[model samples]
Target: MTSYNASLRARLMPIGLLLIAMSCIQGGASLATSLFPAVGPATATSLRLIMAALILWAIFRPWRWRVARRDWRDLLLYGIAMGSMNFLLYQAINHIPLGIAVALEFTGPLGVALWSSKSRFDLLWIAIAIAGLAVLLGLDHGNSDHTINLTGVLCALGAGGCWAAYILFGQRAGEVNGMQSAVWGITIAAVVIAPIGLVNAAPAITESHVLLIALCVALLSTALPYTLEMVALPRLPTQTFGTLMSLEPAFGALSGLLFLGQALSLLQWLAIMAVVTASIGTTVTGRSAEPIEAPYPD
Candidate 1:
């Protein structure tokens, strides 16, 4: 390829990968809802992780490979973070609207991204994001049901914090290849939840349809997009990757509507756009101080 085409391809690759990753996230939610009627968020999240771990382990056979002890530790930490983050976020979603839960959970990354803002422009972005969140809280119209559930919001925020940690540990885990890190990390997560998963997974496993759905969820939610991201990460800048990830909430809202018939209120939709715009505005135009690498192998 020519130099210009190569550069274009480099840029486009990340975009395409990110798009697919977001689609997977959206698909995950839809699939979970379809698989388990009235399923609690914790159960759904646990099942997804378990299924993903099984699939990855079967394919990679990380036992046959080797990795550094320090890297193994990083993967374990990343897996713990992933497990906790998913559990809390799903808990939030059970109480609140999925879109709102996702938006709230995004604050963790946004906060990390905005941590070093010496400029008024950074403050402006923060203000914009806060405004968007305020709209999301729906305090103006004084609709009680529309108001966010405090516990749920807190859980979402906790999930966001875990997500930020996941990102941090993920970089360390991704340093070496062959997906050994992912395998170990996911194994750690599954082990951590083994007690609860045993109780919840048994019922689903017994049902052939649920088993099929769980496998589908694992592929769409965890495997496919994660692989795509691993491929695109080296090609994209840290800020660019963060900006692309910011589009996840938008994709989630869209997917919820299309796949699960979960519609957002006009206010909620606007709120999602507001946070998304702020996140994009901050990342796409601004430079990230730290470089972030993808966590898994594509």
Candidate 2:
């Protein structure tokens, strides 16, 4: 009985970690958005990245691991991608609902997952994702703004593209220094984005609540979630991890609804489901789970 229970616990622990990681990330996004009205996305992204970078550096003590000059390019690229994702996704959530922004941003990794696959079934998943995106893009119709906010949608897509870049560059960077590379990458992102963010958010930097929320965003979105993912990665099978990670958009939607009161139409729900389904299908059926199982910066 003891052995059986231990086995069951081992099987279940990674699942819980992934779930918690997703919740933290989405919850953090919702929290971050609350600051948008006061300081805007630039400031919020800057604060999150800066704080997260510091936390990661302290935890990893990256100075212990030195990188070759040859590998610095990959780390730099990865960091730039990370910064782009933070800035663009925050900008996206500023203009669009959290769920929609996340759903759209997911296309980046989805594309990466589908890339290099020759399976015929992958085409179906691609089509489903596209259909979901089509409906998602139409969601802002009849709102006070009139028509969809193309800027938000575009920003989400751009964020997704950066995610794809992060995956590719991360693979290369990891070969050199593993998680230390992530620390450097995040630090690089902070350096690149801090100037713009500080300028934009300078007016509200003195506010206590703003600082508190930014700290929470850093802990919840970047530090906590990334730590959870790193812990869960080795324990879970690649496929299981990928499938669970695919539910992140749904988590984002739920976070938006629960935290931000951003209720969606039934059609929007269905559209998000389609994207979720497509991601699941692709992961479950893919030849390799490498792309999906990669540690996400979301």
Candidate 3:
């Protein structure tokens, strides 16, 4: 088996990286909502990616390392995608409830899964999930602001598309130069977001508590989680990783409930269940005729 596939097998095991990814995501959401209230999503996101990149750069010292110029270009694109995703998703969360924002964001990958599938059964699962989303979103027509923010929903969708790109480019970066590529990729992403954060959140930096909260958000969301994901990604199949990632919305919802006191109505709870069930069903029973390839930052 290919090294990547072998790694996938290991990570796909129930007690492996899958659990770590979920944990990281859960921790990240809780941290973002509670600690970084003063900072906008973009600022919080930029701080985390920048701090995480700094840590990884210190560990890898990728600067002294050399790569082909072409590879560097790929890493740059990867960083852009990553930065965009962070900014957009955080922005989405600012306007919409965490659960709804996450669910909408997931549509990007869900669309990719549907488009890339060769199996009819995959189509069925994707259709069911999309229909469920439609039903859930229908509740927003004349409801509380928490129901949904159309603008935020669109932003979440944008972030999801960027996430798909990040995965695609990231895979290439990983393939070309192994972990070194991730080090550089995240650095580039951090640099890209730095200016945006400065412009949007520099004032808040003077606030002692805001700085502290930003650091906390950075550590839980970007620093630790990215490290764990990098360690895990190499070991899991692309399809399995995608399927496993379908849990992010559910995890986000749970985290919000636990930490932020975000409550869900019966319909919202049912929508969450529909997504969780469809995701698990697809992952457990759906067999891929060909390996699933995802896009990432290069």
Candidate 4:
């Protein structure tokens, strides 16, 4: 009985880690919204990526690791995808609520999961997801303040597309040590986002408070979650990991409500639930095409 209990604990620990990682990431995103006024979203994104890269590189010393020449293509793609995804997501949350933006962005991965499926049941899930999105975007909730922003929705969708690319390229790049690959990938992302951020909000980026908040965002959104996910992924089955990750939108909603005071209406809540169900169904049905290395949301 003692040996069995120990084995069960070991198995459960990774799931707990993944849940903690998702919560940290969603909470971090809510916190980041508070920084947008002080340092524009672009600048905040740049700072977060730069700080995350610095921390990861310091810990992993990716520079000390040798990379195969063949891996460079995938690494570059992964970095570009990561940078674009973060930048776009920040832009999205600036205009939309965190939970809604996350739900929209999740469609990218959902699309990937459905892309390879020949099952009729997958179509049902797809239709259900579309209905959820329609309700999310089109339903008259009787509050004029609840109107959806088309541009923000587009930005979230763009981020989702980039996320799909990240998953694909990450799979190839992740053949290297997880920490090392993350360091290099995040560093490259920082480099890519730097020029745009500087051009848009150079002076704001220099503020002491902005720097502090950016560092916190980096630790909460990237470093901690990435570390936890890396630890969890190898231990959990892909289906279990994906199902757990499906809770991210709900987590985002809760964090937004708690930290940002962004509340969802009943219809919106139903929409979120619909999307969540689709995601969970996809995972449970084994149609999810997620990478073995879990994707990180910033």
Which residue pairs show backbone clashes in model 2?
none
RMSD of each: 3.0, 1.9, 4.9, 1.9
lDDT minimum window of 10 residues, candidate 2: 139-148
lDDT of 3 by residue, 1-298 (tens): 6999977776565436556657666667567755346766667777777777777777768767778877877788888988898788878877767777777777666665555555557866776687668656765357564356687878878988987777667767766766677777778888998889778675766787766766676666656655666676676666567667777788777777777777877777777667766666666556546444432221
Q: After superposition, how far is residue 169 of candidate 2 from its true place, in Å?
A: 0.8
- RMSD of model 2 against the true structure: 1.9
Q: Which has the better lDDT: candidate 2, or candidate 3?
A: 2
Under the 3 Å rule for N, CA and C atoms, how many clashes does model 3 have?
A: 15
Q: Could you tell me which 10 consecutive residues in candidate 3 have the lowest summed lDDT?
A: 289-298
Compute each candidate's TM-score over C-alphas: 0.87, 0.95, 0.83, 0.94
Candidate 4: stretches off by over 4 Å? 139-145, 287-292
**Clashes (N, CA, C under 3 Å) per candidate:** 0, 0, 15, 0
lDDT of 4 by residue, 168-266 (tens): 788888887666777788988999997788676856678788888889999999999988887888899877887898888889888889999989988
* lDDT for position 123 in model 3: 63
**What lDDT would candidate 3 get against the real structure?**
0.69
186-207, model 1: which lDDT tens digit per residue? 7788777555655655354567
Better of 1 and 3 by TM-score: 1
* TM-score, predicted candidate 2 vs. hidden true structure: 0.95
Q: For model 2, state the Cα shift of residue 72 in Å.
A: 0.4
Evaluate residue 24 in candidate 3 and report its C-alpha lDDT on the 0 to 100 scale.
65
TM-score of decoy 4 = 0.94
- Model number with the top TM-score: 2
For candidate 2, give the lDDT.
0.88
